[model samples]
Target: MRISSEEELSGVVRDATGPLCIRGGGTRDIGRPAPGAVIDVSGIAGIRIYEPGALTLVAGAGTPLAEVEAALAAEGQRLAFEPADWRGLLGTEGVPTLGGMVASNASGPRRVQAGACRDALLGVRFVDGAGAIVKNGGRVMKNVTGYDLARLLAGSWGTLGIMTEVSLKVLPAPEAAATLVMTGLDDAQALRAMTAALQSPFDVSGAAHGDIGTLIRVEGFSQSVAYRSGKLAQMLAPFGAVTVERDGESVAALWRDVRDLAPFRGTPGDVWRFSVKPSDAPALVDGLRRAGPVERVLYDWGGGLVWVETAPGRDLRPERLEGHATLMRASTETRARIAPFQPESAPVAAIAAGLRARFDPRGILNPGRMG
Candidate 1:
């Protein structure tokens, strides 16, 4: 079923006879497959409002992400969270939509500095499982006292509610950008280099490592970017010779590869994402290599985010963990057996269950997609 308006969507959910798989652009098919009739929200899409002067924009949840980006580009602004496009990695052929970005809380390499998609989200309008229309937060950026359900709904994977529209805070696009590349470093050295670059006072914007090299991005006015990139190169000289890439297009292309895990694209293996302390990244990689047939690995967010490609159907969760591991991509059998999201602790699990019960009393919204 397809819905073109909030009232139409609410009515559909209220009258549903069985489970419903709420979908936007369908680019991100990461979570466990939900068994139900697909409710296509792509029809309820278009920009509702945009104020470049106030750095604010509001749009339908199903608005194509490209449309939003193009509109923002024309105004010299952008979604600072740098949302990633998972089509190549997930092997799903569909345009990414605004609702999907928020639902998944999708973020890219720049998250280390600018924060995630949820951080930029100002407010949202969604329909609860009981067919009640709910609106939370505000259209402008400000602090508020109370439960921030707008952010709570984010990264919820549509389990709590189905978002119909959203308001976001945006930022002006940088005047210039450059990346300092350091090659010939192992995971440990790369982590060290990334750490140093991030800790520096030069205001680095992105830090990532993969088969290519260790990358440190600095953005600002042309002169400021030049100075920072040069200083970053000198500071990181101890790791290896630093090669600075200043061409705007080249710098963007490099980060896009890192942001999207381009190296693992089209590979024949299951993909896993690990969120841990930057200090633990190298050791985690070492342990994983020792324990299994790991194929490829990439580090983002200053080594805090680990993307691993490994043999299919393998339960890669360690006996003890400081953070969490998620099964990002896998076969139907593998996803069915191994939980796609990290299992929550007893206390946390209870809280989540209670929230689901309260928001989705009928248990009909995108059931089991998170687990």
Candidate 2:
């Protein structure tokens, strides 16, 4: 079912007899076999408002990410969170949409500095299971006291409800950028360097390490960027050979690849996204490598986001690792065999269940998509 208006969507949802798989751009709609109807929201697309001076944007849920980014670029502003375009990594040939980004809480390399999609999110309008339209949060960014359901919709994976419109806070794009590369450092040493850079006053915006090199990006005015990159290099000189790449094609390409996880795109393996502390990332990688062949790995977000590509069917839960891991990429058969999402604790599961019941008592939206 394709819906262009919230009223039509609500009526369809109200009269839905079975399960529903909500789709925005269909880029991430391959999770589970559809139990019943498929509501494609791509028809409901447009940019409702963009206030560059106020740093706010409101758009329909089906608005393509490319369109929004282009609009923001026109105003010399961009989504601070830097959401990832997962087509290459997921092997799905479709444009990404804002609704999908928010649902997944997707973030790219700049997430280390800006934050995930949820951080920029200010408000949302969604349809509950009973077909009622609910709105939360406000256009103006401010501290609010109460249950913030708009933020809750993010990363809920559409189990709660179907988002119709969204409002987000944006920021000005950096004027200049530079990356200091620390080459030839092993995982342990590289993580140490990343931690040092992140803990410093140099304001590292992006930190990622892999087969290429350990990179720490600094973005700002040309003078400030150059000075900070130099200071960061001096601070990290003890680790290994450090080189600087100024803002240009090379530096932009570097971050684009890191943000998109381009290295692991064509590799034949199951990809897992690990959220672990910087101090423990190396140990987790060590344990995983000992278990099976880890085809590729990229440590991003100051080693907090670990993207690992391992041999097919390899278990990603390393010993003594205290963090969540999600199967980001795998065949439908493989994903079904092993739960795609990380399991939650009993108490946490209960809380999630309560939220789901409150928002979607009929259990009609994106059934079984989380698994």
- Candidate 2 local accuracy as lDDT? 0.87
- Summarize candidate 1's per-residue lDDT along 184-292 as a digit string, tens digits: 8999999999999999999989999889788999998999999999899899988999999999999999999998889988998999999999999999988999998
RMSD of each: 0.9, 1.4
Candidate 2, clashing residue pairs? Answer: none
* Candidate closest to the true structure, highest lDDT: 1
State which candidate has the highest TM-score.
1
* lDDT, candidate 1, at 278: 99
Scored by lDDT, model 1 comes in at 0.92
Q: Candidate 1 regions off by >4 Å?
A: 143-145
TM-score list, all predictions: 0.99, 0.97
